[model samples]
Target: MKLYHYPLSGHAHRARLFMSLLGIPHELVEVDLKSGAHKTPEFLALNSFGQVPVLDDNGTMISDSNAILVYLATKLGRTDWLPTDAKGAAGVQRWLSVAAGDVAFGPAAARLVTVFGAKFNPEDVIGRAHVLLKRLEAHLADRDWVVGTGPTIADVALYSYLSSAPEGNVDLSAYPRVNALLRRIEALPGFVPFAKTAVGLAAAA
Candidate 1:
């Protein structure tokens, strides 16, 4: 297996983290996004979208971080990572949607504006981050894991950007439950953390 990724990309980290948690050994091929390597003709053949974190499992390529998590979990037959029952699977799917939707638009986008110099309204994305964090804090109040009894891909899906939310100036201190959840995930075996960028709030400090 080969993972084409960028170190600073949370999307790429999610895929890499899961494989590590499951003890799946693979090769890491860093894509030089700064130099427009992702847009090259060779890269386009792997993913037309020209994004990082494309997984190549023996020539079968999978794009999208969430989709890659699903593929790897299901392929490995790891029910704990992704439930098999309808209700359990649906529960995981809900957060996966949140990861792609609210989490993407909120915390992830906020980080993009600061860390990546993306042209998005800082106030807008910060507001979105707070809103999403409030909801997640409430949801995680009574549950240690996102779904079922053990950690799932949903947790992996949301962990990267949310853990690095401080870089976006979306404070995590207000959400203690969210913080506890992050700490728990960090303590999990084989957990590989996303690389941190000391910008945004860190710079202000």
Candidate 2:
């Protein structure tokens, strides 16, 4: 298996991290986002959006972090990572949606403004992050994992951005439950970390 990704991309990190957690053997191909390598024809062919974390297993290819996660979990026959029951599956999907929506527009967007110099309003994006964080903090209060007693893809989906939210100027200190969730994920065997980028509001402050 091969994973084409940028080290600093949370989307890519989620895919890579899950693969590691599953103990799947894969190679990491770092896409040179700074050099615009992802915009090339070869790269776009793999992902029309030209995003990082495109996975190639044999001749099969998949794009999008959450999509890749589902593929690997299903392929590995690990229902624990992705439950098969209708309600359980729905639970995992809910957080995947949150990862793409709330997490994306919140902490991820805030980081984009500082790290990538994107044009998002810092106050708006950061505020969005806090809103989502408070909700997650409450939701995770009595739960060790996102959807069940054990770890699942839902936990993996929310791990990266929430752990790195501070880098986007969204503090995690107020969210003890969320922080505990992060600590539990980190303690999981075979866990891999998302690479840290030094550019963000936390650095400036």
Candidate 3:
């Protein structure tokens, strides 16, 4: 398996992190976003949206981070990471929606502004991040994992941006339960970390 990704992209990081957690042997192909590599015809052939985190498993190509997570879990028969039953599948899909929707517009967008000089309003995105964080804190009150008694694709989908929210100026200090969940994910065997950047340094970038 090969993962094409940009290091600073949270979407890409989630896919990379999950492969690592699964103990899957893979190659990392770093896409140079700064150089317009993703915009080229060759790269866009893999993903029409020209996004990072495209998985090339043998000849099969999968795009979108959450979709990659689903594909890997299902194909590998890691039912522990992705249950096949309707109720359990729906439970995980709910949070994967949050990862694509709320998490994207919230912490991920906020981080883009700081780290990549994107034009989103810092105040607005940061506020949105907090709103999502508060809900996650509540949802995680008595649970270490998001959708089940053990870690699943839902947990993997939410990990990258939530753990890196501080770089977007979204404070984690008030969300102990959320922070605890992050800690538990980090402690798992084969855990891989998202790259970290200082807020000041990211802003200057």
Candidate 4:
């Protein structure tokens, strides 16, 4: 298996974290997003959309971080990270939606703008991110993880971007509950720190 990703990307970090937790061995192929490497003809053949964190498992290609999480969890028989029961599954899915939607658009985009100069309206997204953080704070008030009583793909999917929210100047001082959740995820065994480039982007092109 080959994971084409940028080391600093939170989306890519989610996949790396899961692979480490599952003890799955695969080659890490870095894609350079700055130099337009992801847009090149050679890379476009692998993923027409030309995004980082594209996973090549044998001949099967999977894009999107959450989809990769589901694929790996299923393949490694680590369903505990993604429960089989309908309610449990839905709970995980719900958080996944939050990760892709609110989390991505708000804190994640805010960070990209601050650190990478991505064209985003930080003032608008910062307020939205605060609202999302409040929701997470309330949800995590009495729970250790997002979905199940234990950590799940939901937590992994959300942790990377949420942990780095401060990079975007989004203060986390008010969300103690969310802070606790971040600490718990950081303390997980076999956890690999999300590696970011000095420029705050992923390692691969």
Candidate achieving the largest lDDT: 1
Candidate 3 residue lDDT tens string, 1-205:
9999999989999999999999999999999999999999999999999999899999899999999999999999999999988999999999999999999999999888878899999999999999999999899888888987999999989999988888887878899999889999999999989998888324444
Task: Indicate whether candidate 3 or candidate 4 has the larger TM-score.
Answer: 3
With a 3 Å backbone cut-off (N, CA, C), the pairs that clash in candidate 1 are none
Cα-based lDDT for every prediction: 0.93, 0.90, 0.92, 0.87
Cα lDDT over the full model 1: 0.93
lDDT by residue (72-91, candidate 4, tens digit) is: 98887787899999999999
Q: What TM value does model 4 have? A: 0.93
Candidate 1 per-residue lDDT, tens place, 1-205, comes to 9999999999999999999999999999999999999999999999999998999999899999999999998998989899999999999999999999999999999999988899999999999999999998889878998898789999999999999998999988889999998999999999998998888886665
- Those runs of model 1 whose alpha carbons end farther than 4 Å from true positions after fitting are none
Ranking according to TM-score, highest score first: 1, 2, 3, 4
Worst 10 residues of 3 by lDDT: 196-205
The lDDT of model 4 is 0.87
For model 3, the stretches where C-alpha displacement exceeds 4 angstroms are 200-205
Clash number for every model?
0, 0, 0, 11
Q: lDDT (0-100) at residue 42 of candidate 1?
A: 98
Over the stretch 1-205, how does candidate 2's per-residue lDDT look in tens digits?
Answer: 9999998889999998999988889999999999999999999999999898899999899999999999999988889999999989999999999999999999988888877888999999999999999998888778788897899998998888888887877877888888888999999999998877766546754
Kindly state the number of residue pairs that clash in model 4. Answer: 11
